[model samples]
Target chain A: MKGITVRSPARAAELFHALADPTRLEILDELKEGECCVCELTDRLQAGQSRLSFHLKVLKGAGMIVDRREGRWMYYSVNAEALAELDDLVDSLKQAKRARRATGCC
Target chain B: MKGITVRSPARAAELFHALADPTRLEILDELKEGECCVCELTDRLQAGQSRLSFHLKVLKGAGMIVDRREGRWMYYSVNAEALAELDDLVDSLKQAKRARRATGCC
Candidate 1:
């Protein structure tokens, strides 16, 4: 996975670290529908305001999602570009595995 | 991510958790080359035998890799089927994102 020089293991680790939490993943699932304000997300997820806010911060910090403020409402949505990067990284690993198989490394 | 009902968040969380550590990721990288005994992995990773063993156990627990023993040597390799399942999950998320965009979820 590393010898392919695709990306550093640290970056992959960071991305996975961000994704390790069930709550955070649930938050991402909600955002996948569309951008939504914190209040809406809190209501939909039935999570405490503080708890939802904490998870939102983690997702944002990992660049997995982005936020915008309109008036007093802060809206969040999936950061598609970031997710695409992660997708490509996983694909690279998969492709590498296939290549190894073709080379009879099984 | 979840509304699609393809897989549970807990399962996704478990997979991501297994990938969260840099050392574990490095161990996976080494295994990508093909099956290797723990001693060879330790030398390649330049990690203490016990430490490497610990990470290998974690990876195996998460179903990301499998181990086999021949005589006194234990060998580890990536679980290609499991990794393929992970690949499909990620691809589903990415496709869902694209579909959302097209559906005017932006």
Candidate 2:
């Protein structure tokens, strides 16, 4: 809850669900290089504007990315803070798994 | 590819999709304790046998768990190897995302 130590199965499911689409994953890939407007992303991804926007909304809603308006274009970038917390969660999971193994729980 | 450095959007999507459901996440949580049979899990989770089996199938198909037959009961445990790779993938993503930010790509 505080930093990647996910105790709620529902929350874990929601977070993972946000990353469960190919198109959305591709959008994240594009954003990996930097922030970009929807137009540039649409052009680079060669995806329809509407579909791209939908995926963007999913990622944004999940707190994976953030958007800023600059004149006519809205630029989107990965929410580094949010993503860092996700990374921390993964680390905690790994540790938990190891602890389980050590205790011969499974 | 070799470890958790995921290069394919499609593969990442597939892996994440396998973990997107609350039931599946619950199953993973149950397995975190150790190997369990369908009956034990169903009793603990208060879910129906058919639905639990379906979730188990999904987890197994994703290489996240393995099943074994022991006389009359079938047992399952987390595929620690696969899960470890997934953890590694998360680590790599964190590094990649950080690298992108440092270079002011976004």
Candidate 3:
């Protein structure tokens, strides 16, 4: 919600829907720095493991996060490929903002 | 999936989940040029009205798209704020890529 504008209005709603939840957004903001173990995430998020697990799983299933097992702990990180797609997603917002200058959309 | 990378791994999953569908992604891609009517989308996507409407509704609910009604036709565009957030999302991916260079995640 910083620099990019809406380029693809149709998909904007659905895109934001994934981020509309406070818990999910918070979880994502937390992961901005780097990968964290479930325990650390739980402490940082102040969320129960059950909830954290669910959120983490959602992120993972979306191909947003990937994990590596270290002994009994699992470490997770973001998917670069998906991230790039997101960049394009945000670019649509930028285009939409510019669309205001052009009224030729069909 | 171009320039941006994942910034928030956890959120990445949630974000991508919002866009994982071919329909949703296609819708977003189509709108990238500018606002388009359901008719145009329907034509471009070669999908039925019911399905297009359903997909459009989903994108709107997700905050990816905003609509303006012109007589009977509905015109939709993307939201820039959400796109910026997406840029940040992709940044996490760039970081993750860099993180690969440094193995000090806690």
Candidate 4:
């Protein structure tokens, strides 16, 4: 089994922190359907434009999501690499559990 | 592809919030070796007892780690179930990314 390694605890924490919000999770869910413009997300999420923008910024800052400006609209989609990294982080915890169980250390 | 379903955004956020701390991640790393008593964790992480306790509490509260009382000591270990759940959450995002790319939604 591959060992779980968090080379940068700060970076992992930042990624998790970006995921620690209901609004942001909703945004991610919305974006998961496909690239969405700001107006579409605001309507779908029923979030105020400013509030939605803040969550988008947080997700983008964490590299969890990517955005592109198309003329007047900004489109957003989930970043697959970041999600894979987060998956690896969770796998690390699972690996630790396996190691502890195997060693049965007390 | 299995769709990503966030049944409860609040609960997901709570779990992610528990993991959004560098100290807590460090603690998880230590426990990955095996079950650890409070004193051992304090020494290994170089964290004061109170601070450590706070992080432990958060992890425990979110079901990220489990504790057992053994006479005068409390041992901690990672919760495999919670980690699995977190992994699934991350997978959901990945699935979404795939869906978006497959459809090429704009």
Candidate 5:
């Protein structure tokens, strides 16, 4: 389960850090099913407008979520391919961990 | 080339933080080819013993790299499965980015 986790350590680290915060993770979850406007996200998320915006900004910065402006409203979507890749990557880690000798060093 | 990247934003952020530091990134790069002992890593890395240990600890904490202690010496190897998963995830991102509409945001 260790070592053989993610390819491109830098890339992995970048991706990991992008979702480091709970708020950001929450935003991704909200968008998992489909795109939603800011109002919809706030109503469903039940968070302050400013706080939600901040989280959205972070997610967007990381390229984990994309938003489009249709007039004053912004619609957000789950980057489905990204999510699929993530599961597969983790699955790969699970497989590698089985073959690898689990080291004690942590 | 934006708003479509790594899956499991949380996982991605974790992996990103693991390699966030230059030292950690360098350590990862060194391990890219194969595993190495602390001494070998130190000699090749030309970094302080304490610093190297700290970096190794961070990488280990994030499951980016693994080490096996054969006596007092520890051999570290890149988790191949993890590496493959990381690339595939990125490729997935590339695909999503290409298909998704580019949106302008702060």
Candidate 6:
């Protein structure tokens, strides 16, 4: 298991913000199956190219997904490292919850 | 470890949305230490009472935090079950990433 490296609350908030949208999460779900071309994402998500592109940009900006160019097409896939980082963030929160419970503070 | 029960992307998005704000994350950070009165959170986070209350409502609405009223004071703390559910959500994504990698898909 990777050691949890707690992120600053602001950084965590940024990452969570990126994940907070239904459209972006849908795009991620598509890419999770495998790398997908922009055309495929637009078709599968039933979103306009411009609309999908906007969400893609947000995911890419947050380091949640990575993109590559293949000739005229753009391919995207989930960033494994980002998912690992998210796991760490959750672990840190869980640890905090446990610590709080240990104190038995009301 | 608890088994991962995957949440729909929309549901995941809703939870993440509640966590997307820096102020909400800061409030969670303070509560992670132990349950705190609303007045203490307002003082520690340097947020106006109404503003802090708004964030608290969002957190509570998403089931991320629990609140209790004692006399005239309201107290807040992290919800351990919600953290566990978030852990599961991350686990599902990690599993997807692994599955994608195993397929050797570009």
Best by TM-score: 4
lDDT by residue for model 2 (A1-106), tens: 2223357767677777878888887777777656778988888789999999899998888788899998878889878876776665555455444223333212
Once fitted onto the true fold, the runs of candidate 6 whose alpha carbons sit more than 4 angstroms away are: A1-6, A97-106, B1-6, B97-106
- What overall lDDT, based on C-alpha atoms, would model 2 receive against the true structure? 0.74
Q: If you assessed candidate 1 against the hidden native complex, which CAPRI class would it receive?
A: acceptable
Clashes per candidate (backbone, < 3 Å):
0, 6, 38, 0, 24, 0
Candidate 5 per-residue C-alpha lDDT over B1-106 given as tens digits, one digit per residue, 9 for 90 to 100: 3344345666655655665665676676666645677887788779998999998887787678888989888888776655665665445443432232244322
A26-100: candidate 1 lDDT, tens digit per residue:
888777767778887777778999999998898898888899988888889889888887887676555454233
Q: What is the lDDT of residue A91 in candidate 2?
A: 53
The CAPRI-style docking tier of model 3 reads incorrect
**How accurate is chain B of model 5, given as a TM-score from 0 to 1?**
0.76
lDDT of 3 by residue, B1-106 (tens): 3233334445555544556466776777767667788888888889999998998887776567789998888898765555666666545434532233254435
* Per-model RMSD to reference: 4.6, 4.8, 8.0, 3.4, 8.6, 4.7
DockQ (model 1, Cα): 0.38
DockQ ranking, best first? 4, 6, 1, 2, 3, 5
Weakest 10 consecutive residues of candidate 6 chain A by summed lDDT: A97-106
Off by over 4 Å in 3: A1-24, A79-82, A88-106, B1-20, B80-82, B88-106
Q: What is the lDDT of residue B90 in candidate 6?
A: 73
Output the chain A TM-score of model 3.
Answer: 0.69
Between candidates 3 and 4, the lDDT winner: 4
Which regions of candidate 2 deviate over 4 angstroms?
A: A1-5, A95-106, B1-5, B96-106
Give all TM-scores, in the order shown: 0.85, 0.83, 0.58, 0.89, 0.58, 0.85
Native interface contact recovery, all models:
0.45, 0.46, 0.16, 0.72, 0.13, 0.60
* Model 5, span A1-47: residue lDDT tens: 24543466555445556656656666765565456778877887688
